[model samples]
Target chain A: MLSVLLASGVANGLLYGLVALGVVVLAKAANAFNFSQGDVMALGGFVSYAVIVTMGYGSVAALPIVVIVALFVGVLSYLLLRPLMDAQHAVALLTATIGLSFLVKGTIRLIWGRQGDYFAVPPLVSGPPIILFDGAVIIPLQHLVMSGGAVLMLALFALFFRFTRLGLFMRSVADNPRAARIVGIPTELVLCSAMVLSLVVSAVAGFLLAPATLIFPDMGFSLFLKGFAAAIIGGMMSLPGAVIGGVLLGVTEVLVSGYISSTAQELSAFVLIFVALIFFPRGLFGGRSSRSV
Target chain B: MKLFSQIVGVMLMTTALAVPAFAQDVQGVSDTSIKIGTFGPITGANYAFGRLTMNGLETLFADVNAAGGVNGRTLELVRVDDQCDPAGAIAAVRKLIFDDQVFAIIGGSCSNGVMAAKEDIEQSGIPFVNFAAASNNISAPEIENIFTSMLTSNLESALQAQYLSDLGVKRVAVVAQHDAWGSDRHKTLLPALAEKGIEVAVDEELSMEANDATAQVLRVQGSGAEAVVLLSYPKPASIFLRDAARLGFTSSFIGTSVIPDPVAFDEQVAVPGATDNFVTISPSRYALDSAEAAEWLEKLTTKFPDDEPHTYNLYGITAGQLTVAALEQAGADLTQASFIAALEATSGLETTFAPGPLNCETHQCLQAAAWIKRTPEGKTEVVGLSTLD
Candidate 1:
């Protein structure tokens, strides 16, 4: 039971964690929530489909095109906010991102059209399953890959933040933008870099999910909600917190669907989010939060 | 003076002949062309059905027109977009009748939407040939002008139950969404299963919007059932298979009508070993191997490239057959009453529609559905026709 639960949890948790990274990349470094994050993820999948399916590039071979689209989306997002950033403190920036979300989703609908595309992904190297107890439950190679992908992404993200100059500049901008600007650090470029990183990470998440779940336009909404729940549960500012939050959320959904009922699966996370907000507003790990007053 | 008298005499004769000429009900005559209105969701999630249905209907109309149309007049189709919504459907009916002044209505894509429009459609004294709506409500005794061209869920489940019986399965499990649609299917299907002496070991419910059906599957697995009957649409059906595979549960899986669709079959096969055990209930004619269906498919594919030769595609063609037959029966005048008379006159008429055409009475479609078969490479095929319990 444990193995089966974990295996199922891993496939879903990995994608959720990867998406949560988008939140961390933007919120932690730039103190912005690109409300269009989910829509952008969907757009990436559609763009990938357009390249791979419509253009007849093999699904795996379409990676270069995916990266190009991701970069373009990043630049487009920057342009979307460049005007808003001039004023800076208005909640209207978030609202504009919401508008951007609709525009992107609608544009994708117009360009890709609304039909389910069954992508032909390469077969995962499946191996003989290892039995936990009864032959009823066995672990497969794909489960391991999913778990490994999540752990590797989490570790790599941590390392990137710890060891890189661009990462350092992003943190400096997030921490003290005025000081960084006075010190002659190019804060705008740092912010732009943060947005691009977020976009690339989200695009990767989209690609990862497409192989498992057929790409649908409305797919990102539920995923986006779960990712946000993980971000909050982990402490909005902590990357590790987001990963734990995501895995916990995925497992919680499965468990609730298993033990209580599947109907209550969606309601579980929202209820958890509400309870967490009431009790621990700073999340389990996030200590002190600084907001621009 | 003689020439002037002759001219005046011809003019008087012409006026006398032209005056009071509109008499004798003129066979089934309208002012100009025979106007038939159609309702379908042209721009919503179900737009594919609507678009393809219209395409098929137009192809038939084109062919009819090429043959000098029914009794010297062309068929003019006034199309309306219902967006697959009930209210939208009601408005569509109102517009088709009150605004467009159509002679008859045909080919609505959804069941519930068409059911909601039943009252106004019947009240308007217009004949409605329902192209795709399959709920029993449309074909029940009360609605007069409505004629169903698609098979109902009840018919589908009975067909599936009988198919499983033929597979020698003695016990089955059901995982259905906790909703009216699922419950209606369960109600219709369980009796058929009981008749086959197949005990239902587990009956489970999952919400329509639920993404995971692992817990539901575990319950079914624990019940020790031999075969699993999935009462679901394609989305939840695919999700259930994925969750089941991940949990490493292996059981023969049977699906609802919408579940084992060719497009959906490809998606479900991605669910790790789901292809091996997957089976579904579909009409026999949609089966690629149906030798009798060959010529029909040849014509359908030539006309509609995107639309596979599915049961619904047959329904569109059947609608065309009925429409043309009705127009012909309506005679030279082509009145609405004559069209309804033509529809009522429908019997065990044979056509390329798979079934020996449709018998208007008992509303029992002669073409019973078929057994589920899986291709070696995970593509699905509808097996040969079997008895429906």
Candidate 2:
């Protein structure tokens, strides 16, 4: 029973981690949290459902379609918010993203709200659970795919940020925007690129997670809250810290529901956030610097 | 002298026309049409419940109109979207009553939404035949001019308890969502269980959008429960059953009309032999796609080409049928009082989708519930029908 709980906790942790990665990326590059990140995830899930289920495109075909849609959304958001990003403070920019979130959520409702309570995506693989420990621990194949896919995507993101030219440019922009601007870095382009990168990451998370969780317009807000909590707990600016925090939060939530009470499960995140804010302040792995990667 | 004669003729003609209008002074009632209004969530997450139910009502109205109308007056429906919220339901009901001046109303998809607007409905004195919304409070206080065609939550909960008792199953556990809909039923279920001399071994709460139920399931299993009552929607219920199956824990899983379609439930579970011990109570005897509902499905599809028929649609169809029956019984002089009297007098009326006779002798119109099970071959079969005590 303990092993099963741990496995389930880790599986959900991976999903939270993926969402936190998007939050961390945007927070680092733009110095503003994208309140609309969850809505972007929702839109991605709905688009994938449309392509794969409604449009009769195969699963493999859904990948490129999802990418194209994500790119368009990312670019459009960047263009629309460019003026606000240039003229407004971080708080105002964050507020504008909240508006954008509502707009996107409403638009999705108008187009696909009638689909039903939820749209299901067939798992990447289908079969019975793989039993371990003399049938004590059982994990679904879809869960394994979700956890593994999340890890692979995170690893690739880490590599892109560390070694690539654009990655270094984004890092430099995060470190000191004024300095990067003086050194001939196209700061606006870097910001736009970050927005696109965040959205793309959100789309990937939505697609991978939709199989385990059903796709719906309202699915975004709760997920965004969880991911945000994960980011905050892991030190909102630290990518690796975000991942670690997400896993820790997820495991804690599952265990709370498993051992304590389900009502406590819902309250656990808020409690964790409260305690982390009061004690750690910088979070588990958060550094002394305000900006981190 | 000629002008005086002309004036007299005009006055006489006016008086003649006014007399007949006074004789039949009901709002929304013309010589050729009777207007009824419906309110539900037509454009939000709960759109399926509202829009599809309206589609069913519209199809019935069309059929009634096509069959030479009801009492020589065509049935017309005015629809308003409540968005499945209490404030929205109240405003929509008020608008339908005052602005639209509908003679009657036949809609309410969400329980809390309907209950929130119940005061307005009762005070308006407009005859209402609720199509959906299963909270017992909607009709419990016995409000005049208000009747519900859907089975009440208390009745369904009582029946679920009765089913467990009949099977001789002891040590029952309940896993329920804490949302309004689930809570309403859960509150009623405890008393019903006690009436049968049973005590719940364990009780757990789940969220409507929960992705995992391993914790809840493990706790229930550890409590030595032989049966589990699941008061949940399809998603959470499916997850709980799947997890239970994974742990090799098989117990009799009982559900209510929330999971009307066993076949869909099985698919959502996505585990072989997971739902073998599952049983659910449905207000209707047949699934929307079943042979018994072919005619309803045809009418629904023809009326709404883009929308598909669902079990929620069946609720609307039954409500529509009940409304038409009441209107027909009210005769050509269709006043609100006459309609209420006719509805109260309704009993043992057969409907296409309802499991048994729709009885409105009480404020609760529908009392019968059907037990449905999915066989190993993935076929849904009606096990038995019971009228709630």
Candidate 3:
């Protein structure tokens, strides 16, 4: 039972980390947290549903389409909010993203509301359960794929951020956009690229998670809240911190519900966020300077 | 001048003779049409209930019109989106009654929403036929001119308890959501269990959008429960079933009308034989794809290209059928009072999906519940029918 809970916790944790990664990436690039991150995730799932289920494409074939749609959404959101970003009213920019969230949600309802709720997507891979510890721990093949896929994506993102030129430019912009702009970093392009990267990460997360759970217009808000909590626990800016915080939060939730009461599962995230904010304001691995103005 | 005055007087007299007089002043009735309004969450999370119910009503109305309508008057639907909130429902009902001036209403998809708007409906004196909201309070006080075709929460809870007791399952646990819908059933179920002198082994709460239920299942298993009553929507219930199966804990899982579609629930669980130990009570006897509902399925799908017929749609169709019956019985002098009287007198009227005779001696029109179980072969079977007090 312990091993099963741990395995499930870690698997769900990785998906939550992916959501946190989207929040962190957007916050870093645009200097504002995109409230529509979850909606983008939902949109990605819906797009994949349309491609794979409605358009009769294979699950693998839907990947490129998801990427294309994510890219389009990212760029469109950037263009739509470019004026607010330029005006430098951070709160207004964030508020505008809220509107964008509602827009996306409403559009999804208009287009796909008739499908009803909980539209299940078939898992990318399916096989027999991988049992261990004398049958005490049972992990489905889909969980393995979801966790492994998220880890691989995170590793690729880490590599891209470390070794790539555009990645370094994004880091510089995050540190000081005006300085980067002065130093010929093409800060706007970096910002747009970050938005695209953020959406791509979130879209992939949605694709991984939607197969296990179901997809609906209302699925985004809960996911977004959890991911936001995860991001906050990770200091809201550190990529690695986001991953660690997400795993910790997920495991804690599972453990709390497992040993404590099931009613506490929803409250566990906020509880962890409160504790993390009080005890480790900079997060466990977050830098002291991670806090933005 | 005298000739012109005489001609005008004669023309006025002839026009007065040409006018027809109605038995009573019906708000929304005309010589050619009768407007019926419906209110539900057409655009929000509960759209599944609202939109589908409306679709069912529309499809039935279309068929009725095609078959020459009720009393030679075509049924026109006036839809209002209440978003499944109480205040929204009241406002929507008010708008439907006043602005739309619908002759009757066939809606109320959310329990709290319907209950909140009950007073407005009762006061308006409009013939209101509820199709989806299941809270007993909506019809419990026996408000005149208001009737519900859906199974009431208290009745379903009591019937579930009775069925479990009849099976001699002594140790029963409950796993229910904490939302309004679940909480209402839970509150009713506890007392019903008390009436049977059976104490619940355990009572646990799960969220509406819960993706995992290992802890919940483990707790219920720890409590030594032989049976589990699931007061949940399909998603959480499926998750619980899957987790229970994964944990190798096989308990008799009983559900209410919330999970009317066993086949859909089985598919959602996605585990082989996860639903083998599952049984549910539904207001309707047939599944959406059942052979019995083929005609309705075809009409619904054909009429509304985007919508598929489900149990909620069945409720809507039944509501429409009952409304039409009463309209026809009202005998072309369709006043609100006459319509209400006709509905109150309705009993044993057969519809396509009703499990037993539709009765409305009281405001609770639907009193029969069908026990549906999913076999190992992935087919749904009706085990029995029980009419609750």
Q: For each candidate, what TM-score against the reference?
A: 0.83, 0.90, 0.87
Cα deviation at A165, candidate 3, in Å, is: 1.5
Off by over 4 Å in 3: A55-58, A176-179, A288-293, B1-24, B28-35, B41-48, B54-88, B245-249, B270-272, B288-307, B324-335, B345-352, B374-379
lDDT of 1 by residue, B1-389 (tens): 67864564454334323322544332223555677889988785677667666766766776787788888888878889998888899889878775776667877887778887876776555678877766666767645567766667777777777878888999898888767667778888889789878999977776655544656777777788999998876666766776576556789888765643643564544654665677776543455445765666676678777765554555566677778877787787555666777787777665464433566655434446555566766445655565443
> What's the lDDT of the predicted structure labeled candidate 1?
0.69
Q: Rank candidates by TM-score, best first.
A: 2, 3, 1
What TM-score does the predicted chain A of each candidate obtain versus native chain A? Answer: 0.86, 0.93, 0.94
In candidate 2, stretches whose alpha carbon ends up further than 4 angstroms from where it belongs are: A55-61, A288-293, B1-24, B245-249, B267-276, B374-379
Candidate 2 per-residue lDDT over residues B1-389, each given as its tens digit: 67864564454344334434675568778999999999999987888879988998999899999999999999999999999999999889878876887888999988989998886777667788888888898998788878999889999998888888888877799999998788999999999999987779988988876777778887898888889999988878887887777667898999888787787778767667878989999888887767888888888888898986678888888899999998999999888788999999999999987888988988798988888888777777888787766
Which is the winner by TM-score between candidate 1 and candidate 2?
2
Query: Candidate 3: which docking quality band?
Result: acceptable
Q: For candidate 3, report its TM-score.
A: 0.87
The residue-level lDDT of candidate 1 at B266 comes to: 49
Give the Å shift of residue B190 in candidate 3: 2.2
Cα lDDT tens digits for candidate 3, A89-181: 888898998999899889888898866666766666765668978787777666688789899989999998999999999999888888998
Looking at candidate 2 chain B, the ten consecutive residues that score lowest on lDDT are B11-20
